[model samples]
Target: MQRDRNQIIQAENSLLASYAVRQDETGVREYPEAEHPYRIPLQRDRDRVVHSSAFKRLQYKTQVFVYSVGENYRNRLTHTLEVAGISRTMATALGLNSLLAETIALAHDLGHTPFGHAGQDMLSDLMKDFGGFEHNKQSLRIVTFLETRYPSFPGLNLCGETIKGMMKHGGEYLGSHLGQERKEEGPSLEAQCADVADEIAYTSHDIDDGLEMGYLKLEELSDLHLWSDSFLKVKEEYPDLGGKVLVRSVIRELTNGMVSNMIRTIESRIHQWKISSRADLNFHFQEGKRIATYEPEYWEKVRELKSFLYRTLYRHPSVVVTSDRGRDIIESLFYHFRKQPDSIPETYRQRFETEGLERCVCDFVAGMTDRYAEEMAQSIGFKSKEA
Candidate 1:
């Protein structure tokens, strides 16, 4: 027996919470199309995001360490997968739309530039006189305007709900250019899950990467309450465990603790806010109350951990050197393309007539991976290849 789209949606609705965004409630897109027989709208949207060219480019983009740093370090693609896995787990535990959460997680970093945050910061500074650059807005641009998968539409033309989830994945909406209706309220619970999942995945994985790369010693993190508590528990269980095994166990425990706390806190918030339905969630959101969050105490700990990572791992001399080099490459590429607009591919060149030279150049440079950006910089004589 083959269950059609409606049947699948019905099953999904039955399993999800009242406050979860239903497939039937999605807004219409710029290009309307028929739904697939076997796939729900959100599922199709997830597939479209997975298949996008920008999604593929994520494999080579940096999460912290550049691609040339080592194959074992987390790149954008691995980070996206980690976020998706964590998001789906939280969404399922919270009785929200797991597929939407996963889709948003997968698409959230689709706009990240070549050397992680460093590349993004440089690009933003370069484009400051223009419209400025933000990865969230760039991710939206990739799905809505840049990706050319369909002959009928300019982009993937994903469901409105999925796009909404992506726009609000960071717990805030910055797509004011998307018009008034898209700026109605805070993100849905699914988007909230994805946002927290991003935080969890990066916080845990960056520590793992730092430890492996020798930038962060295990003893150094022993002082942080979150790490100390998790480390104590893991050590209790595996007394003989040391090295990578011990580190991995502690990271696992830390992530698990955070996810469990987030779920518990959100459940309490839902009850406190009287949010029994999606409408109620939206009402509370529009009223300037957030229904999804970690407990205040735990959130403070997370902030402390983040500060530690920023000082120790992110600002470590080796990482700083790479980031500085990456910034130089991005700046060089931006100026090179800005001067010789025709040097860019015809596809981007055509966009210059509509988006202006700087904006078009920004788009072209932003889409490049670490290796591509470095190679382009060398080719343009902006820097030596060995440099």
Candidate 2:
């Protein structure tokens, strides 16, 4: 077919909805450069993200269980991949930019500190006196500042749309301090897809992992409306289904049900709100309304499932013990680096001079893998199996 960039962009524009973010309308990169000859802006942005060092580091970063917990649990990288896959499916079904959604989903967790949310929480508390630490902001920082790829730019020089997607992948604008123009509204349809996909991926996979680890029991989860419904459907389909097979079927059905509901609800909202254009969507968002959401009943089910996970799995004593140990390791590493800024790698030491001690230390700590963090902590006499 030999479609050039313009032709590919035109094809995409023709297929996408008016409310979908178009490649042609995307804002330029911070460091302006010539476009790729073959791939469109969003495609190139996705490639850059996939090829980045931070993206690779996600392999060893924690998602729920720490890396040392077991090989069977989902790590940060696997979670990101699942989110991207789900985002692409949702975006395609919604007639939005699937590539953009996938890019955002992949880059969404790039800033997550080692040891999952526990490490991030610890760092956030430590950096409260500074500007505060957040994975959303850190992801932006990695793409725009920390990752020095090309000689002309400090970051990957991704398109503004991709950066915006990353910033708003949580369904809200966290904050942008890189001098980029801030959006007054919520994320675009693609970003919103990525956001929901992140939720779907984690909720389902966490359930799978929890069950595998014996932290959560299927009998207990049956009380949740979402779980009960899926379980009943799977049981009805295969009356003899039992054990892991039944669990897998239920989880698959659960994810499928959520995705189907999300798509249907979004379509209904688009029609109800008369959102025929991107401007309409933006206006609704500016008015503090979401165009992308599940129906009320489905949303309630989601909430119930979340609450159950939090109560039974996330706050379980075993999980809490590991989380607390991770927190202590993060804190120890932060103070150690803060006191000896020169002890950081030369690359980061140079950043310390410009980004200040706290910011540099935070970046260095945030970039570490779970095993690396543990090793660093153990080097300084912190005693623990993981540390």
Candidate 3:
């Protein structure tokens, strides 16, 4: 059951080792190679990610709630863990690489700033010259340079498919779509799973978080097409399956829902557009064609859930105010420092000389825990130590 580099290398046209070559603000991944007797290749990949420092950093980074508000609200780390839980489940059910799915889930947001997307937007504007910025790509960078394991190497040395998801995980922002040619990497089925896995977790957890925070009533949450009734039925029948109990199964069910929806949307769109062949997911190279659809009624319910999260969970006044401030603070910091990375703190400065300024800046930001990043906002001259 044990598979190694030579084994995996022969299985694919190439294994993406270059990503493991970059250094984080700390310099290198500090992992030790171990000979496991019975772990599969992808499983090994998953384990490496969970053990990496960068993966641990996810805890301190942003999720829906800012890190400080509530200990329970998902932080980047918790979010990653949840994503992995659901991903492994899905991957296992589908007979894909459970480890690969889990690895991608854990590393998906490694590049997110201490403040989440708000922080990424700011850095992207500043680093537009340094090929811009991306959390997925940064996740790739984390395993490669910052995590520190392979003495002879810098990154986790993951597979090509894993790296591809890290590179192109979100929106179809093809190279140069936003002004620069996209990284010379293609999409893979694994990345697709990671992307879908994120959606599944976010949709379900945000509601759970909403309920936890007292913003959503269970009745409100369960008001969907069979979804609400089904959730209630499960709660009523199992009783014990309440709270975070069946979260994984719910997410698995949600994945099926979303996938089914996407299938219908694609099919309907194809017919509407007069397109032929089910090649939208061209890279998937699917063999058997299975019919899937998101029931219109269910779609409406999902939309309602999505809207509720946006308005209640994401757009809560307190959260919005802080996130808005977060956006401003991070943007200001990146703009000034991108021009003079030497302005970065001494620990970061010494590191800057090796990786150049932009990356050094990215490392400085990415390395921060939520509280520390907000506190350090002052050193860069973006307002004062006092908010």
Each model's lDDT: 0.87, 0.88, 0.61
What is the C-alpha lDDT profile of model 1 across 238-323, one tens digit per residue? 99999778889999999999999999999998888778987787788787777567789988989999999999999999888889
- TM for candidate 3 is 0.70
Indicate whether candidate 1 or candidate 2 has the larger lDDT: 2
Residue 145, candidate 2: how far off, in angstroms?
0.4
Question: Which whole-number lDDT from 0 to 100 does residue 366 have in model 2?
Answer: 98
**Which 10 successive residues of model 3 have the least lDDT summed?**
19-28
* Candidate 3 wrongly placed segments (more than 4 Å): 1-40, 169-188, 217-223, 235-297, 335-340, 343-356, 378-387
lDDT digits (tens) for residues 1-387 of candidate 2 = 798999999988898988888879877888888877878988888988999999999999988898887898899999999999999999999889898999999999999999889999999999999889899889988998899778999988888878877765233343553233436545789888999999999999999999999999877998889999999999999999998999999999999999999999999999999998877887888887886789998899999999999998889998888899999999999999998888899888887667788999999999999999999998988875463
Strongest candidate by lDDT: 2
Show how many residue pairs clash in every candidate, following the order shown: 0, 0, 22
